[model samples]
Target: MRTKQDWEWLAAGSEYLAAVAVRELLQEGKSMEAYEGLAFLIESMGKSKKLALRSQLIRLMSHIIKWKCQPERRSSSWAITIDSARTEIEEIQEEVPILNRDYIESVWDKCFVRALREAQMEMGKKKCQIAALDWAEVFEEEYWFEED
Candidate 1:
């Protein structure tokens, strides 16, 4: 069977996350590790050459800003994006099979990492080795350096 629509769902997730950001207005955000991991995940998804990921990410970022500045926007924060790609985070949350943040984040994290790793490997095979090696070297070196 064909896969269910993932991007539309992710767009919804982004919308939800953005709303959360606005509601919490997290002054001190997640660790750099988390952010980097998430960025890696996003970039990996971007490599698919699919506009859905980019469009979704852009929409999500907007919501995050809205959530960050919710105090200023108040109720209008969640309605931050109205483009064709825009979907209500609340709507997405409702469709969530599991209604927990930790579970959703875990799934997102795993999917992101796996996608990135595979994408990197594919690039290496494509003579995108220079690009792939540069990325691999930095993290691997840092980890090895710390072992000394």
Candidate 2:
């Protein structure tokens, strides 16, 4: 039987990681502090450094990481703490005076990658004659071809 627990934790991790990566990309040009897994968690989730954003990122990150977090928990890539995630999210939500194309491009790329990940999962789970979902990070560079 396919227990919910089997896919729950991994799915949560993947979702949060993808979201964080996208949020970081969105805030990349705005703040220098967000270069490495979000700076602090006081204000926002991304690079905003505002208390308001920090709070939200913390909440989202905490929800993603869940209660199973070990005391010295460490992901291969630095795990953005619940606090930091909130701060990062806030930074991304901030309005910039003008449109920054480069930053926008980065965010779009991240979002594209995320969407592909989600699509891959859906494509993998089929009723008749299941197939392997080869959506590993290795082929992340491939452009997604959609029928429209």
Candidate 3:
């Protein structure tokens, strides 16, 4: 199983390589022939990052929905899952700051929908009235912790 550390290292390496590839492409006169691989590499890396974040965001949102809709069922495991997802997203943003804003904005609605569906299924409810959470609330570490 690839642990969080392994994923972090892979993300860092991908970001570093993409930056180097772009720099070299610029130095080599910016010709497509000289940098075709770079485009593919960057695009692939971006997709991978997006998918990873998307999965985590969905999981996080689902847990948050569960907590809100069924507070009696909350447990340490759910809190940990929320924290883990938040950390992964933060790490991705730190590694690839350029993609942070657009990625979150583009994927938020889709993630919310998936999360809602998941929560409904898990809770055995045909319909849930939970609203889409604010992005800021989703990412806020304080929200993931149990209120004292």
Candidate 4:
């Protein structure tokens, strides 16, 4: 099985190729074309990173909501899901160091909104009033579980 590190290397290679394409276009004096390629590459990278982070965030949020709304229904599986999401998010941040606190802050609310919708759907609730948890709470390992 390909490990996470292997996937990260592939992502890095893809980014490098995009950067090289932009650089070559600039050297050819194709300023407009270069700008277009560069912009597209940058936007594509940002969106990919955001989507990855958002998915993990949603998983974490959904589990937290489930844990809170139905404390009795909590299981080791829910805890594992939360832990796995946190680990994946950390790995993503390590790979793309630019996805720092500021980037998280910019995207957190939007992700949380989507997460809430997802949690409601998954939990079969008409409404889930759980507030967005703190960043540390969501990302910290073992934050929700007494034992994992």
Estimated TM-score for each candidate: 0.21, 0.22, 0.71, 0.68
Residue ranges of candidate 3 with Cα displaced over 4 Å: 1-34, 141-148
Candidate 4: tens digits of C-alpha lDDT, residues 8-99: 44335687776776687688887776666666666668768878987888788878878778887888889889888888888889988888
lDDT of 1 by residue, 1-148 (tens): 1112433343235644433433343334544433433444454343332334333433443333333333243343244342222343334445442433444344444433444444445334332222212212211222111112
lDDT (CA) for every model shown? 0.36, 0.35, 0.76, 0.76
lDDT of 2: 0.35
Angstrom error at residue 42, model 1: 22
RMSD list, candidates in order: 21.2, 20.9, 8.3, 8.5
Which is the leading candidate under TM-score?
Answer: 3
| Clash numbers, per candidate | 2, 21, 0, 0
Error of 2 at 13 (Å): 19
Question: Could you give candidate 2's per-residue lDDT for residues 41-129 as a string of tens digits?
Answer: 21123233233333443343332322122323334232344334434553555553222334433443444444344433534422312
RMSD of 3: 8.3
The better-scoring model by TM-score among 2 and 4 is 4
TM-score sort, best first = 3, 4, 2, 1
C-alpha RMSD in Å of predicted model 1 compared with the true structure: 21.2
How many pairs in model 2 have backbone atoms within 3 A of each other, for residues 3 or more apart or on separate chains, i.e. clashes? 21
lDDT of 4 at 56: 87
Model 3 agreement with the true structure over 15-125: per-residue lDDT tens digits? 666556556767877656335545555666877777888888899999999878888788878888889888988898887786586878887998899999999999999
Question: Which 10-residue window in model 4 sums to the lowest lDDT?
Answer: 1-10
